[model samples]
Target: MTTLVKLDHVTRRFGDITALDDVSLEIDSGRIVGLLGPNGAGKTTLLSLVQGLRRASSGTVELFGGSPADARTRRHLGCTPQETALPPTLRVGEVIDFVGAHFDNAVPREELAAEFGISELLKRQTGALSGGQKRRLSVALAFVGRPRLVLLDEPTTGLDVDGRRALWAAVHRQQDAGATVVVTSHYLEEIEALAERVIVIGQGRVLVDDDLSAVLDQVGLRLLRLTTPTPDRVRALTGVVDSRPEHDGSFTFFVQDADVAVAELVRSGIQFSGLTVRGATLEEAFLTLIADSPKQNDAAGVSPRGI
Candidate 1:
């Protein structure tokens, strides 16, 4: 795949605070990459640099081999910011046409609207639309130009399950049509459903970057829930990362291999019941990654909050 965007040792600062710290990564064309992090993790700042909304304090940022700040470079980019303020009085079709005017080869207005499931509301005024409709329209506008690269920052902030799935389908179609997409979202399930690669950031720095399967394998986690009185012994078993007690005399153990842990429990005569083992969710894998990430110390040797 062709490299669409590149950042080398990039750092962004606001006043006395650093928002991104010595970050380096590349987005390849034709891939849907998921950016995962907690609140204030500098995910937004990173996207801003790529969108040319903010300048990097140090190092380099390249969009399609040109400076992101250049209009020529930005022309091939489409973005849906976290907050969207559309002209309320304009009809939905008019609003779509307004955004399409910026690109010389814009997608047909009606086709674009239909692709995003807004064809029925094209005649409705923007102000009269529901929250979900507004959100979908905000996202659909990003594809109006048929951009080569799309950056979506929490695109489904206020949508029901069906709405979210509809948006996801539109994104998949975009990728299938040869668009590279970078999605920054708090929803783990969204990432799991949309991304082929996952990048995790913490404390304003890159914590994990790999294929989705490899990221899950990096932690090799399995959630084991059971009833056991000897929590200490359960925790001491090999392959067990940690264990926590529940109110109903149950324990949830983070383990590498449920079979190994269970076998060990039986062989050692450790008392356990109500045993159940399940695969880790993307959220569980993400939490484990950030928890084990080393905090980057600042000039004063203090750990600062993620920007």
Candidate 2:
């Protein structure tokens, strides 16, 4: 696959703070990439650089094999920020129609409005729409140009479960049409469902970048819950990394190998009603990675401006 976006030794600083430090990354065409991090971890800064909204203090940012500022390159990109920027007095349809005018080839106004279930809202002013409705309209406006690269910052923020599913369907439609999407979201489950690759950032630097499954395997720890009367005895097992007793005579043990630990528990003749093995989810893996890193302390104080 060809590289759609590239950042080389990118550094952005403000006075005593460093928003991005020697960050280098490459995003390929036709893939959904999840850009994840806790607050102030530079996810938004990176996206801004890609959109040419802010320039790197040093180093370079490239889009479609050219500088991000190039008109031809920028025409292929679209962005939806975390906060909506529509004119409050303008009707929903008017906002999209205004933005659509900037693009050489835009999705038909009727078709785009219908796809997001906002055709009825075309006459409603932006301020009159509900939170979820506003979010849907914001998302629809972002895709009006049908650009090859789309950047979404917390796209599903105000959506309910049903609305989230609807947004996901639209995202899938974009992917089918060959668009590369880079999304920043705090919702790990949504990211897992939409992204093939996950990029974790910490302290203004890239911490992990790989296939979502591979990253999970590397960072995910397993837990074994054994329902036994004698919780203290279960805790004494050799392979038990950590154990916590539940109120109902059961103990949950964090372990490296569930198979090896379960066999030992059986061999010891421990009386148990049941046993359940649980794998770490993307959320757990992400939290564990941040908690274990020393840089997490530093990440708390830094904030990127104009995100």
Candidate 3:
């Protein structure tokens, strides 16, 4: 697997504000990578730099072993921004056709439209389409050229559950066809399902870059739901981190060690109707990473409404 993209000590600034600070990362070909972060965390800035939409203030940005601005590199990269601007008067098919023409060898316009369920919408004017339809059309445009690398920013925005599932299928199809995908999404579950590797960003810096499973392991909190009659006794246990009793009399405990905690509960002579332990979810890991960072303090000054 060759390196498809690399950012070496890259930094981007806007006057006194630092959007990215000494960020370094490498993404390989044929892998789906998730670029995740809270608002103002530079996830979009990083993508913009990599796609050549903006220049880095310091260090280097490379795509396909060449500068991002290189024509050859551009041919292999496709970007779907969070907000896509479409010509109001143009029909959906016309927009895709126009974008596809930019590449030397584009995917068939009809095929791309059909893949995203936008075939029926091809004849409709871009402005007349619903938000979900517009989102689908934007995604279709990104796939028009069948580029080796695709960058999707908040791809699932404004999509309902069914629409999101449809988009996920299209993404999986791209991965199956050997394209490298970099997605930044607000939906943690979507990232967990689509990305093999996860990169978390905070304060314009990389917080964690590793296999999804490995990153989850670092945040080792588990939720244990038990149907014990002695909920009070379980709450009294010293090892239990936090315990809350449900209306149904069941107790759910947040614990650091499931095996040891359960053993202790059993030894306390409590009979449980059921005991289940669930590992930390990607959402839990994401929140933990952001909360633990010193940058969280800076977030306070950015207006409470925005934070």
Candidate 4:
């Protein structure tokens, strides 16, 4: 596969606050990659570098084998930032037409609107649209150009459940149509839904980069929640990573093997009630990684910045 985006020894700083550090990464053509991180963890900074909204302080960033800032490179790219600025007085149809006019291969206005479930809002003035409507419109605009690479930064930020699901469907359709997409969102379920590959960043450095299943395996942990008379005994159970007493006298245990923990509980004759076991979520994995190593710089030989 051709490499659509490349960051080589890249770094970006904002007056000594390292937004991205010693980072090197590549995004190949036609992949759905999720970018996850906490606030100020450099997710926005990385997307900015890719979109050519900002220059990297050091290192190299390339899009389609050309500088990201090049007009030729940008012509094939589409981006929906966390916030969008739309012409208040413009009707939805007019706004679509304006952006669509920029690309030779733009998708037809009617078709794009239909696909995004915003066709009915075509006659409405952008200013009168609700927040969710505006969000859907902003995301739809990204695809108006029939872009080969799409960057969606918190694309569903203000969207309701139905709106978010519609956007996810649109993203899936884009990927199926052969666009390489990079998405950043605080919602882990969104990432889980749309991304095949996952890149987890923390404190401006990459903590994990792998296929979604592999990344989850690396964070292999189960949570066991139950009510026990002896909370301390649960903490001492084998394979238990940690235990926390809930407000209602229940205890939650982080365990490497839930089955083993349960067996131990049985052998100890512990009368645990309301036993529940669930797999760890992406959010849990992300938090664990951050908690384990909140602020570690990259290796000395690397540079920084990404998306």
**What TM-score would every model get versus the actual structure?**
0.87, 0.81, 0.80, 0.85
Tens-digit per-residue lDDT, 173-210, candidate 4: 98899888999988888999999999999888888999
Instruction: Write out the backbone clash pairs for model 3.
Output: none
Q: Which stretches of candidate 2 lie over 4 Å from their true place?
A: 224-255, 258-277, 295-307
Could you tell me the TM-score of candidate 2? 0.81
User: Sort by lDDT, best first: what order?
Assistant: 4, 1, 3, 2
In candidate 3 the C-alpha lDDT for residue 171 amounts to 92
lDDT of each: 0.84, 0.81, 0.81, 0.84
Instruction: Give the residue spans of candidate 4 off by over 4 A.
Output: 81-84, 226-251, 261-275, 294-307
> lDDT tens string, model 2, 167-273?
98898888888888888888886798799899998678898899988888887677788787787777788767555555666766766688888888889998987
Q: Candidate 3: which stretches are off by over 4 Å?
A: 223-255, 258-279, 297-307
Provide the clashing-pair count of each candidate structure.
0, 0, 0, 6
Instruction: Name the weakest run of 10 consecutive residues (lDDT summed) in model 4.
Output: 298-307
Show where candidate 1 strays beyond 4 Å. Answer: 229-233, 244-249, 266-271, 294-307
**Stronger candidate by TM-score (2 vs 3):** 2
Error of 3 at 195 (Å): 0.5
Instruction: Give RMSD (Å) of candidate 3 vs. truth.
Output: 5.5
